[model samples]
Target: MNMKLFIFIVLISPLLASLSSFILKNKRFAEYISLLASSLDIIGAFIILYFVLNFKPIFLFNNAIAIDKFSAYLILLVSIVYFLSSIYSISYMRLAINNEKMTENEFFRYELFFNLFAFTMLIAPMINNMAVYLIDIELTTITSSFLVISEVTEKSIEAAWKYILVVSSGISLALLGTILFYLSGNIPGSANIVSSLDWTVLGLNAVYLNEGIVRIAFVLIVIGLGTKVGLAPMHTWVPDAYSEAPSPVSAMLSASLENVALYGIIRYFGIAGKSLGFGYPEVILITIGIFSIFIGVMGIIYQNSSKRLFAYSSIEHMGIITLGFGLGGIFGTFGALLQMLGHTLTKSTMYFGAGNFLHKFKTKNIKKIKGVFHIMPKTAFLFSIGSVALIGVPPSVIFISEFLIILQSLKDGYYLVAVILIGFLLAAFISLLTKSGSMVFGKADENFKAERGDFSPFSYVPMLLPLAASLILGFYIPNGLHNLLIGIVHIINFKIK
Candidate 1:
């Protein structure tokens, strides 16, 4: 009954489910196992949130696993998003079942990898040691690599290979940076290299650390992690991976793994600012942010593949989120957090809708499928709403967050950054609208066939709840949630209005 025990149980539940599933040998049961694991995880996250909001001790297992206000909020959000995405997977995977696209063994491989992926995302947020965290992230690559090729197609294999190569190379660089940092903190007199990997300790001693070494480590870490994060020039893997992976896995990659990478960047910035002054990380992030925005917007403008378009849009939003954090004030930081949360919900919803469309139309080409709303009204409606949110329209949380960031930048007199950001956002908006709007209202091809099947609650509920919550938050920020967010902003040392 102890809360700590429950927390540990939830943390371990996905791996437990995977083991049980290995014995069961039934892929059908694997979905159920994932659902159960996700449910318990969400419940545990809620419990943690409750304790944190009441200012109760949120540590578990040891001081090693503490949930401060910032992490508590993110933990709860990831749980909700992860659980919903898992449930949605049940429906999304039904296409694979019907089409016999995967052998039984391969299907079971999906079950195993899915659980491992979820488990890694769950634990990455909780780990205090940089070495341990890097290990956890490497595990993510190991788990997700199989999922990338769940289809067993030549293109899928190619995509998976590229994903593995790029991400592994990036992560290895990051690990080296982490080790160098550990070495930097080794006082010749003390045998405490491992102790330096603790984020709290590194943050405290950042001032005493060598600035040049810190800058080098930061560059290596950012470049390495930014590939996984889908930043510009380093984002080559994103479109191919997203296009080839099973829809459910694509959703998880965009929604969960991307967030995990962002979390790492946030943690690094926290330490870098305290140790080397804020301007260093800020300039790098801003430059990368601007370049990513340009790539995403330009890529989306002429994108033919629907999934690839969404992938590029995701890069743009990641850029926008980075832009907010790069500005580094209370409003900028809060807006960044809000955008991160909003994008997870909105982007996953978009992918779910896209999956349904892809299944019904049997194509990823946006031009091939038209008049979707007329044929599949619910899916079309959801897709339209998701598109609006992605474009940062009113009543979507992204709009609120983006507005705040722009305001903060202007007030700070970063006028050129503001101008470039706003321009890229508008360009992204136009690009998205062109594709989604055409698909919704245009005439269907004479050969187009509308596949009819019973839609599952798992399919709709998981995608809908997050989108609805995003809308509600944009319109009315509840007092309790607002207070919690304020606490989080302060913990991150950001000033909020």
Candidate 2:
């Protein structure tokens, strides 16, 4: 019953918030309701995490709902973003309505889809069926694409369309891969015919599935879900969409949605690794992960738009997490899990800061927006610090996580992989810091007429909270978080054992 209550709070609150926001048509009311809903979700996520850590995996309603440590972790990550984005939204949307000329209807629509997007991500990890999970992901795309165009302009519309088309194509392939997995176990020649598509059943019976088919299905799953994870080649839509979306939506997209998408991929990785012996699946992830990192860094170096710079940074960070999981050691998996939390905190902070910049300068171009420190000292401090954390500097959780992945690569005798990874990290470190640094400390335009203050307490508070957490986690890994991540590593692979 307690489990049910937790589930109810986590899943129902956002939905209720979405409905109330749409029906009320009052912007302030919508903001508070969304904030209230996200607050509830944060409490529920922590409760769920506690239960998962203390007790057995929670399976409810005839195995339709499953909450393991892994699922609980993802839930916690999503809810954190939901809460922060909600707070930041109050300031962001207000500025949009005032400065950017956003209408009430548009704000209503934003609240509606924003909460709905949070709902989809929160529920995804708990769904037992892989097909159903993929479908839930599709629901996320629909809701978030709407969010991408929340401000409603030509570029936003184009980005939304591109996001839908590319990600939808990817979803279709994932669905196809799901179909193949079911067939792989059902083929007549098999000793045990797999009777279910539930992740619980498939994971336990992975070895029984036909290896030949599992191989192809996993690759298809990669390309399909990888598109959503913002892996290179399929990541073309990410920059445009994130650049065009409202900063809150961009944070959800890069920080929360990408993690949820990658969670699906890692599930398949576990099953595929169990069936195909970690080598094949690990290679695929490593190869793709490295290439994606290369693409992300290259994009970062050449990026002109502030939002787009961080969008590409999202791609790069996702690649690192992917590489960590692909390495598949205790250090690797643990690092990847920790990295998820760090990325959530820091990326949201960065995007929130970016949103503040957008409202202040009325442009996304990095060069055009100058002297943030002189204009908005509070935001500049947080944004500058957030960028350092984002780029994996020392005493940041990102730094620790990236270091662990590097350690794992060397431990596994992937010397060349380590070398290349270090090089890319260096390039990203220089490029991101230089780009973001200029905006913060460079000279302000002489004719600039915008106000010299931050937007509101709401704007900087959200950024301050996450940036602090990200830094703290770097200096200290709380015992509970450490235990939780270790549990997840055990869940993902035999390396921990």
Candidate 3:
């Protein structure tokens, strides 16, 4: 079969299975179906990765459907995050099942939408048409809003409503921007007249594009996509949503969906920078990135809820990634991509660790829990390691990536910005270490007890796989993987060395 066809099937199968899960009479069967569908998608991702490694970029069903190193790499990422989340959900959802607060139907609803959310996150990267890309972003927002309030709690509902409003507004602007891009290309006698918004066309003809109109389009697209990336000011919905949602969904939001939004920004920025010079977009990205760093680290340092703290950390890391991108050179862009990969693995691991802690303690409050090492030593130990990784401590992938970013920052003569970046990161490390490390390693509080929990394959695999990947990547990135990433950088027109 054609690689793109196989990938397309892989992408669509989950949505079909999710729909079946919603209507199927046997809920147990639906669970199995969900698992099977995700596993198949995972298999397909591995297969596609193999092809991406050995073959040229695959285009299928016309040029509108294509898979390149850029898209293939992201597909692999979503597969890793979503597959693990799915496994984790099996164990996590069992908790909801036992609780009298949720209905049988409600659990199924949650599973259905969760699958849909994962599917859309995967599909967003492969979309070749701007309209299709906008549509995928809209689907992500809609599906995730329901997932946010799966528990139907008052706070979750508020978060969901806020999410719906903010993301909907953002997507609306993005759609308008997409339309404007088409108009910018359609101006009188200036360029090719294919009703096509193909990236190749846009990039090739970018110099001929109307500068003012293109700038307007880029601004709209960035703000629209920026809301999803949890850039500050537009980030109000993230903490509440992540804190209130089930931890796995929070992981997906922070690790997977946010990355998709960043990809969207990069796609547009590529055109702008190649045509209009990197200065304009770099300034905007830098401003937003710095602000997000300040907000994320400060918020995490003082936060009371463990999950909320992770949410803020996600924002901070995203800022770092954006900062790397804004630097706009080969090394800078490479660092940006590396930072993205590292953050995804680290953030998801952090959330999974947080999920384990939440399951044991049944609380989100940071102060109320302590002596987790005694209660659940394996989980506590893992959580502590994950937190260290999040802080970009040495020998973690994040540390290496952030080191590259900082080096690039200094090399680029952004001295003050580098100082601020270091300051925020140090503050964040101190805050999380003080807040989480003590809770895990210190003596038990009066209410603390090792709440014994069942160990399922589903729960352990998700947490461990990504963490192991982080550890391995941190200490030694495999030569093959390094080459693959270098190829991706070339494909995207970024240079690292």
Could you say which candidate leads in TM-score? 2
Give lDDT: candidate 2, residue 337.
Answer: 88
lDDT of 3: 0.82
Clashing pairs for model 1 are 330-495
Per-residue CA lDDT of model 1 for 236-301, tens digit only, reads 999999888877788788877887887877788888787788889988988888898899899899
lDDT of each: 0.81, 0.94, 0.82
Name the candidate that leads on lDDT: 2
lDDT for each residue of candidate 3 in 77-138, tens digit (9 for 90 to 100): 78778877877787787866674366777788887898899899888887788778888888
Report the C-alpha lDDT of model 2 over 87-133, residue by residue, as the tens digit.
99999998998888899889999999999999999999999999999
lDDT of 1 at 408: 78
TM match of model 1 to true structure: 0.95
Q: What TM-score does prediction 2 earn?
A: 0.99
Clashing pairs in 3: 330-495
TM values, all candidates: 0.95, 0.99, 0.95
